[model samples]
Target: MDLTINDRVLVVFAEKAELPVAELDLDQTFEEIGLDSLHLMEVALWVQKEYGAVIPEGDLHHEQTVREALAYLDARTR
Candidate 1:
């Protein structure tokens, strides 16, 4: 399995939030980026599709940051 975490996830997120990639703070919460639960659900679904990991929607609440989401998906996909 190619375990590389796709950068496209972040790119799509940035685009959805109407922000530049450089402005994204990996440590910041999704709400801080002008995103809400709906956006997080989209991201969770995206990760499931791209990484072949079945991430539960409830798990999104635990992943408060981009770094956390990436890390969670990386572990599950691996």
Candidate 2:
């Protein structure tokens, strides 16, 4: 559970959505950067595969920001 990698994963998703690096604020919601449900599901799958963190469905709704996701993943890895 490398949090630095997890944080970079979040940024990669935002970058994939074509957002500028300067606008990739950790506190911003995924929706703020134009991530739809499908996009989020893809990100969830990536996290599961890359970090071995199993994120249940609908969990992303509870996490409104990248920081929140990082915290959730960090806790789960523990």
Candidate 3:
């Protein structure tokens, strides 16, 4: 089965956060998930490598929730 963009993004975040995918919520902010700036940078790198999309650090930092970030990336990838 093909993973949707949402699933893919969640998996990346979960992996980087060292938490189970089941533990992550789409409404949760990176801060709420215990992810720091370093983790966000790592996620940005993964987005660049995986989707060929260079998300600006400022934009990434501005994202309020996992869902919002995923939507931003999905827009760029498409």
lDDT score at residue 70, model 2, on the 0-100 scale: 66
lDDT of each: 0.76, 0.72, 0.84
Q: Tens digits of per-residue lDDT for model 3 on 1-78?
A: 998877888998998878999998889888888788888888888888988988887677634798888888899888
Q: What is the lDDT of residue 38 in candidate 3?
A: 85
Best by TM-score: 3
Off by over 4 Å in 1: 1-3
lDDT of 1 by residue, 1-78 (tens): 542574777787798789998998899877778888887788778877876788887786634787886677668877
Q: Write the per-residue lDDT of candidate 2 for residues 1-78, one digit (tens) a residue.
A: 654766667676666678776677778777776777777778778878877888887777624786786677667655
Q: What is residue 3's positional error in candidate 1, in angstroms?
A: 10
Worst 10 contiguous positions by lDDT, candidate 3: 55-64
Worst 10 residues of 1 by lDDT: 1-10
RMSD of each: 2.9, 3.0, 1.5
Identify the superior model by lDDT, candidate 1 or candidate 2: 1
Ranking by lDDT: 3, 1, 2
